[model samples]
Target: MDEFAEARAALVTLEKRKQGLIAELNDVHAAIRSQRNKLEELIRRLPVSPINRLPDEILLRIFELILIFGTPRTEDKNCCVRWKGQLAEVSRQWRNVILHSPCLWTTIRVSPSWNTARIEAHIMRSSKSPLDIEISPWRNSYALKDRPLLRRLELVVPCAERWRSLTISSVVSSSTFRVLQRLDHLSLPSLTSVWIERFPCCEPGKFDLPFLQPQRAPLIEKIFISGDIGMLKGREIPSSVKTLAVESTSLRWKITSALLLEFVPCQRLTSLCLGNFTNSEELPPNSIQLPLLEKFVSRGGVSAALICAIVAPRLKHFECHELSAYPSLHDRFVAVGGKFSNVDHLELHAGPQRSQRYKPPSQSLRLAFPGRTQARFSTGNTLKA
Candidate 1:
């Protein structure tokens, strides 16, 4: 019995000693881990490249140029992600510079492929800089429900006060239009430029925005609308608008002189471009005079009466498409020949030749300018200006 008791006591002491050694081993491992962490922190603090020697301002300028030229084109989500990754992976210093530079994040392009986390990261990094927002989808890709894009729009809509320009090139779904309608209630005081293209077919008032009201977007000075001319049919354009562009693949309805006048405020315009306007009727007796207009461009079947109605006294440059196809309009063209008397530069595009009967007589469409005007003429295969 005594020997058995003694053996049991020895076993207890051995077990205790084993536990003590295990505790000591654990302490040693913890100390090694702490030392490794310290070494890593020290290494990070050391400068390893000569590029780090550049001043912050110089680095900022370089970053600005990179962003300016490296910005992804419309619907190019992959390029945008690659650019963000490349800039962040260079080094800790570069990453820090990119994160701290608000201008680098100010231009936000959102597509359906972008994840929520990535979009939020961009918004956070952009800070308080004025934002140039572009929302579109990849070309030739299936149009799926873009939840990420919708979420991004919801996130950025609250920041509309800081928006400098907003461009929507996507096929706006019903949900998208609903969200846009909310903008009418919000104040976009800083929004100066807006461009909307390729809007999906919707009801007459579906795409209307209150921000378009001259009272709402008082600072808006430029507007560009493409795809549908119906989008501008009944809207009252602000007098503050100086530059305007309207383009369509084909007109859904005839653009009358009154409709054209409705799109432009009574004030002088700086630059005006009208493209693919197949059917334009004559203006009313009161002409639409753009006294301060410097540049004017027209394409497709624009009416001669509409051209005659525009009295741009200071017009410097004029461009138009071939007018020979409209036989009945030949006399109208001659009547308006003297309207370009002050135009110094002209470009007439003689479009694809049809039957010889449709060919315009050389002298039938002459410009009787008081001063010499440098003119360029372009046919389908040749160019003579």
Candidate 2:
């Protein structure tokens, strides 16, 4: 009996020791966890990264790359509205980066595809950045009144400081000029291309917006007109004017021809493009002796007399795209012999061998080409073909 009691006491003692060891282990684990949390808290309280100490300008530049030039999706390709809006939603510094980037903000395209309010906001947000605005309004919607759009455009583009290319279009109207006729003063110093078309200025009194002397927009490189080029005749274009493109809705030759002559005064002219001016009266005002006038294009028929004048000059190109036979037109060019002295780049826009029948413009044009040989013509379709 004594031995069994002793054995039971020994077993109880061993179990008590095991239980005490487990309790100690639990206390040790709790202490370790408490120490780990305290260490983590201390680490978090320490001073932040050395990278955060960058200067504001350097940080701003980093934001600019991420917000402006980050990805193809971020770039202002065709003025994507979603990308623009997304940029605004980024961090405040990033927003500033995008707003300051002139290239990202310069172009604002107002179209049926985008929210008009959004477009307006973009324009407003651009502040002093010179705008490259392109708006093609919906067909059915009433043409935007001059007051709503032009007024806003005027606010942004005051006197054309940095505007490079401007294209203004008006929808159909019952009035003389398809829209407002008071375009006397929008001289842009940086303007390179001006294309105004489909201007329904056919009415007699409508197109005669009394001649205002050429307000100078000196850097112009290319000019295209399809609506009434009524007021520009007789006025000397700024000498910087280069390529001239004309497409008229009028079929009358007198009107189209006269306007062509007016452009001859542009002494630096290098190219002339004519579209859909058909019929007989007087040919395109005497081909301005553009010594530099290398390329000539006519989508409609070109009279033999007109071709004769072209051959007479230092033409690098004589491109006639369409031909209609007018009897006895070739007599004068052949009679004078092919004395077209300077023509080298001859492009026939029509089917084979059309130039065989027609004669180039007169040799007399060579002498008169450099001077103010204005087109004694008139028409409204100076832009629309």
Candidate 3:
């Protein structure tokens, strides 16, 4: 009887083990069914485009990058490329699309003074045909020396008349310059960008800046002037201009009440960058306001008091760089940096100063903090970086 009872107990243990294994198998099967059902629902909801089709807009936007990054220059005989690479790692499909699309390889950019014949060769070598060209004239070029490049550019670009977003800088004889007074003399309709850099910096009193009459391109919105700008009174800036960068090294600056009044026409302008404002004086008593001005950046001696005086109510951003007279102002006990009641952001460098070369220009010194004084800087965000 005892032997029969032990064998029966062993049989009961085997039955329990079989039941536990079956339960675990049932739980795994249910989990698999739940995952499969979720996957099927997701597959049904997903659109085919994300996996397969690319629209024309996306293709064009991808292709426009060639225009933006431009072509790369290389001396190796084995590597003739317009631009270096960037889009390759985006995806296999994009890499294939960019590689196959010639437009994505063609828009070539060369700095000024490049030999025109070589650029012509590069353009020819490109398997993908390009219609637009951007060239920076750092200096004149021999290859493009005689070509009707200005005219040819108009012909080659589809947006000619309205497509001229380029700058030309050359110090020509006073006689040749007379012919260029009307920027229309260039007569390329596609023009959009204008940069005029002149050497032997001229002042507004000596050289007349390039002028744009009332009916000039409706598209041109940015104008930058460097070198000597002749009396600006004769030239009427395009009324549509939204940005103006004007620089002059000459001390012939006249920041009188009348000059501030001249800023009225530029009310359409929102950004103004001025450099070399030489004098350490403020605006003449009551100057006209810069009604629409939002940002003002200057590079040289614009007085701390004068900036506060002239900057209108609408101004939002102000940056002053490389102040002219830290050495001259070091004799005073005043600080070297501070913010105006109006300005929210201010930057000042007590300019690595050593000693006073002359008397301080301002009655009070704001940016004059020295390391030994435990001085407090006025800029809320001031620290030596």
Q: Looking at model 3, how many pairs of residues clash?
A: 32
Full candidate order by lDDT, most accurate first: 1, 2, 3
lDDT of each: 0.69, 0.54, 0.49
Per-residue lDDT of candidate 2, residues 92-139 (tens digit): 654666666655556555444545565656666666666665544345
Native-referenced Cα lDDT, model 1:
0.69
TM-scores vs. true structure, each candidate: 0.72, 0.56, 0.53
List the lowest-lDDT window of 10 residues for candidate 1: 353-362
RMSD of each: 6.7, 12.9, 17.5
Q: Write the per-residue lDDT of candidate 1 for residues 1-385, one digit (tens) a residue.
A: 9999999999999999999999999999999999999999999998767788887778878877766676656745467556767877988878888878888777777666666676677788888888887776544323545444556668778787888888877654343454455454777778888887764444456654755776668888888876655656667778888888777643465655347666687565888888776544646522887888888887764676677677887888888776454444456556666666777887766667534334334454455344435877666766665
Q: Superposing every Cα of model 3 onto the true structure, what RMSD results?
A: 17.5
Off by over 4 Å in 3: 1-53, 63-133, 138-159, 169-184, 187-192, 199-211, 231-233, 250-264, 280-282, 326-342, 350-385
- TM-score ranking from best candidate downward: 1, 2, 3
Report the C-alpha lDDT of model 3 over 9-69, residue by residue, as the tens digit.
9999989999998999999999999999999999988886663467645765755655444
Relative to the unseen true structure, what is the C-alpha lDDT of residue 153 in candidate 2, on a scale of 0 to 100?
44
